[model samples]
Target: MGMNEHDQTKYIFAQSIKDLMAKQPLDKITVTDIVKHSGMTRQTFYRYFQDKYDLVNWYFEKLADKSFRQIGNSSTLKEGLVKKFTFLLNDQIFFMQAFQSKDYNNVENYDYQCILEFYKQIIHNKIGDIPEDIMFLLKMYCHGSITMTVEWAIRGMKESPEMIADLLIDALPPKLEDLLSDLR
Candidate 1:
C-alpha cells in the first residue's frame, strides 16, 4: 500500500524531529521546532502527531516494519537480527539521538517495544506455530534481543553488527538452539 498525504506528513515530521534531535534533546524539542524544520505549519503537525513523542514512536514503528521486511529474507533468523542492527548502525545519528534522549530508556521504551514486537513476528514465522502457552517465552526472547541491541547502541556500538550478531547467537538459551541454529 502506498502512503497517503497524512503518512507523508508523518514522514516529514519524523525527519524533522531526527534533524532537530541531532542538535538537542527530545524534551527541548517542541512541535514548533519540528514544523519549522519540516517547513510545515504547527496545525499540520498536530493533525498527524499529537506530540514529538508520538512522532518518534510512529517513526520507530515505520522503521521497524521496514527492517522486519528485510529480515524475513535473511538466511537465518539470527543473521537477520545482525542485519537489523546494521540498519540501525546505518542510521546511527538518529538512533544515537534517540539513545541520548532524556527520560528515555532505550531498552524499556516505546521504540524498544516496536523492535521487540518485530522480533516476535520473526520468531512466529520461523516456528510456524507460536502456541499461546509459550507466549511469555517468546516475549522473553524479544525483550532480550532488543535489550542487548539497544545496550550496544547506547554504548556506542563498539562491536560491529556482525560481531554483535555472533554474540547474540552465542547468547541464545540452549532450548532455542535447535530452533535458531543454522541448518546449513
Candidate 2:
C-alpha cells in the first residue's frame, strides 16, 4: 500500500533525525536541525511530533509494528524475539543512544507498553480477558523484560541475539509460560 502524505512526512523527519543521529548523540540534535535537514518548517515538524524523542519513539514503534506484526500462527514467539533483538543489534548505535534517555517517555517505557500489549493480546486470544492479578504478573514480566533489554543494549549487546532471545523467553513467569507454551 502507498503511504499517505502524513506517513511520508513522518518518514522525512525520521530520516533527517537518523542521519543527524549518525553524526551526533540524540540529545545534541534539535528540532531546527531535523526540520532544516528535511527542508520542512518548524510548524510542520511540531504538527507531526512533539519533540525529537517522540519521533524516536515513533520510529521504534514503527519498527516494532513491522517486527511484531509477523508473530502469528506461522512464527514462534522466540523467533519473533530473535527478529527483534537482531533488529536492535543491527541498529546498535541508534538504539544505544535512544535507550540512554531517562525521560518519562523514554524508549524503555515505550517498549514495555508494546510488549505488555502484545502478550496481553496473546493471552486474550488463548483464554479471554485476563484477571487483574494475572495482568499484574504480566506487567511485571514486561517491565523486567524491557529493563533487561535496555541493559543489554546499553552494555553494547555482548550477547548474541539468539542467546538473548532464548534467555528472555526462558525467563517468562510460570503462568505466562504456561499460557504461551504453544507459541514456543
Candidate 3:
C-alpha cells in the first residue's frame, strides 16, 4: 500500500511544484525551483518528467485515478463529482494557478479526457455499444464540465463542491442521463 521509490520521488517533485505554485504561476516556476524545493537534482526530475507541465498532467491524472478508485462501483456520478471537486477545492491554490496556464497541453485537457474516458467506460459497460450520437454528446458534456470546472477554480470556487456537482449532474443530456441514471 505504500508508495514505491519512483512514486515517492514523483510525489516529492509534485509537492515542490504545488508549493511553488502557491506563491507563483506555473509559467514563472522553473525546473531549478522545483529541484531546489524538492531537494532533488535536475537529473532526478528529468528522469520522471520532461517539465513542470508534465508534472501538472501527472498530478491531475493521479487525482483522477484516485477519485475513481475511491468511488469504485458502489458510488454514483454525483459522488464521483463531489470527490473530484473536493480534491480541487482542497488544493485550491495549486489548481487555481494551474488552471490559469495558457499552455494548450495542460490540466484542462487532461481533466476533459479523463472525464470523457470515465463516462465512455461506464456507458460501454452498461449498454454494450455506444451510438455515434451518444459518444458525441458524451464528449460535448465532458468538455463543458471541464470548462466549467476550470472557470470555477479560476473564479475562486465560491460554490460548494456538492452544489457544483449537482449542477453538473443536472446539466447532463436527457438521453445520457437516462443511460447513466443509476450513476447519477
Candidate 4:
C-alpha cells in the first residue's frame, strides 16, 4: 500500500484491465476503455504499456515470478503445482477471458512458456546426475504438461486447482513423483 505514483498507476492500470476483462473479451477492451477505467490519461497508459497485449504479458510475467518461487521452495512438485494453480484461480476471470481470445496459441503463449520453464527448473533440481538427453526429456514433458494445462484452463477450469494438480501429478511417469519426493 506504500506505492509511489508510478507503482500505483501500474496497479490501477492492471486492475482496470482485469475488471474490464470480466465484462468483455480482450479484443473488445481498448486503450480508451482501460484509461477510462483506470482514471488515467491516454499518455499514462502508453507510458506503462505498449498496448493491452503488453500489459497481459507483464501480468503473466508477474505471475510467473511468484509461481517460480513457490515451485522452487515447495517440498513436492505437486504441492508447487497446487500452489500455482491456486494463484491462477484467484484471477480466474482474467485468465478465462485471456484464454477465450484467439491470441494465445500454446507455443506463442506467455503463460505456457512460463509453466514450461517452471517445470524445467523442478526437473533439474529433482535429478542428481544431469545429462543433456535427460534435460531434453524433461523439457519435452514440461511442454506437454503446459499444453494440457492450457487446455484445462480454456475449459473454464471446472475442476478445483488441487484436483487439477493431482491429476497432473498422476500423469507423470511412474516413480517420478517418488523420485522427486525422495530428493526433498
Candidate 5:
C-alpha cells in the first residue's frame, strides 16, 4: 500500500531519530538535526510533529504496536510473552539507551499499555470471562517483565532473550500457568 504524505513524513522523521540515536543521546538530538537528517525542511518537521518528544513517543508507540501484532497469535501465553520481550530486546542497545533517556520517559507507559491490550485480547479470546483479579495479576506480570527487561537491556542483555523468557514463564501465576499449559 502507498503511504500517505503524513505517513511518509512520519516515517522519514522516525528514521532520522533512529539514525541520530546511535550517535548521540536523545536529549542532544534536536528538531533541526532531525530535519537535516531527514532532508525535510524545519516547517515540514513541525507540520508532522510538535517536537522531538512527540516524535519519540510516536516511534515507541509504533514499535509497540508492531511487536504486539507480531506476537498476537501465539498458541501459549509463554510463547506470546517470549515473542513480545524478544522483540523488545532485539534492539537491545538502542532500546537500552533510548528508554533510559529523559526524552523517552513516556515510552515505558506506552509500552505498558501495549502489553496490557495485547494480553487483554488474548485472554478475552481464550476465556470470555477473565476475572478482575486475574486481569490485575496479568497486568502486574507484564509491567514487571518489561521493567526487568528494560533493566536487563540497559545492563547489557547479558543473557539471551530466551533465558529471560524462561525466567518470566517460571514466575507465572498458577492460573496463567494452567492456561498456558493447556494451550501447549
Candidate 6:
C-alpha cells in the first residue's frame, strides 16, 4: 500500500529526529532543525506534531506498538517480555540517551504503559481472569523493570539481555511464574 501524506510526514519527522539525536542532545534539537533535515516546511511539521516532545512521545509510542505486536506472537511470556525489552532498548537508543542525560522524564512512563498493556493482553488471553491487585502489581513491576533497563543501557548494558531477562523473570510474582511456566 502507498503511504498517505500524514504517514509520510510522520516518517520524515521521526527520521529527522533520529538523525539529529545521533549528532547532539535532544534538548538542542529544534523544530526548525527537524524541518530542515526532513526537507519539509514548519507548517508540515506542526500539522502532525505539536512540538519536539510530541514527536518524541509519538516515536516511543510507535516503538511500543511494534514491541507489543512482537510480544503477542511469542509462545512464552518470558520470551515475549525479553524480546520486547530488547527491541525497545535497541531501537530507541536515542531515547535511552536522553533518559541518561536527564533531559526526558516520559520514557519510563511510556515504556511502563506499553509493557502493562502487553501484560494485560497476555493475562487476559492465557488466564482469562485478572485480579485488580495483580494488575496493579504488574504495573509496578513494569515501571521498575523499565526504569532499571533504561539505567542498565545507560550504564552500557553491563549484563547481557539474557541475564537481565532472567533477573526480570525471577522478579515476577509467583502467580505469573506459575502461568509462564505452564505456558512453556
Q: Please name the candidate that would achieve the greatest lDDT relative to the true structure.
A: 3
Q: Report how far residue 184 has shifted in candidate 4, in Å.
A: 4.7
Provide the overall lDDT of each model, using Cα atoms, as 2-decimal numbers: 0.72, 0.86, 0.87, 0.73, 0.75, 0.74
Mind giving the per-residue lDDT tens digits that candidate 1 earns over 100-176? Answer: 66565332477557655655565566677766645665567667876787678778888998898888787777656
lDDT of 2 by residue, 25-114 (tens): 788888999999999999999998999989999999888777765665425778888888988988888888888778788788888888
Model 4 C-alpha lDDT versus the unseen true structure: 0.73
> What is the model-wide C-alpha lDDT for candidate 6?
0.74
Count of clashing residue pairs in every prediction: 0, 0, 0, 0, 0, 0
Candidate 2 yields a Cα-based lDDT of 0.86
Score residue 62 of candidate 5 by CA lDDT. 71
Give the winner by lDDT: 4 or 5: 5
Kindly report which residue stretches of model 1 are placed more than 4 angstroms away from their true locations once superposed.
1-3, 102-108, 115-134, 182-184
Model 5 is weakest, by summed lDDT over 10 consecutive residues, at: 175-184
Order candidates by lDDT, high to low. 3, 2, 5, 6, 4, 1
Error of model 6, residue 42, in angstroms: 1.2
When 3 and 6 are scored with lDDT, the better candidate is: 3
* Inter-residue clash pairs, candidate 2: none
- Per-candidate TM equals 0.79, 0.89, 0.93, 0.81, 0.81, 0.82
lDDT tens per residue, model 5, 39-95 = 999998888788887887787777766674666556665676666667767766557
Can you tell me which runs of candidate 5 are displaced by over 4 Å? 103-105, 180-184
**Candidate 4 Cα misplacement greater than 4 A, ranges:** 104-108, 125-132, 174-184
lDDT of 3: 0.87
Which runs in model 6 stand beyond 4 Å of their true positions? 101-105, 126-129, 180-184
* Model 5 Cα shift for residue 29 (angstroms): 2.4
The better-scoring model by lDDT among 1 and 3 is 3
Q: lDDT per residue, candidate 3, 35-147, as tens digits?
A: 99999999999999988999999988787677744654535778878888998898899899999998878888877777787788788888889999999999889989988
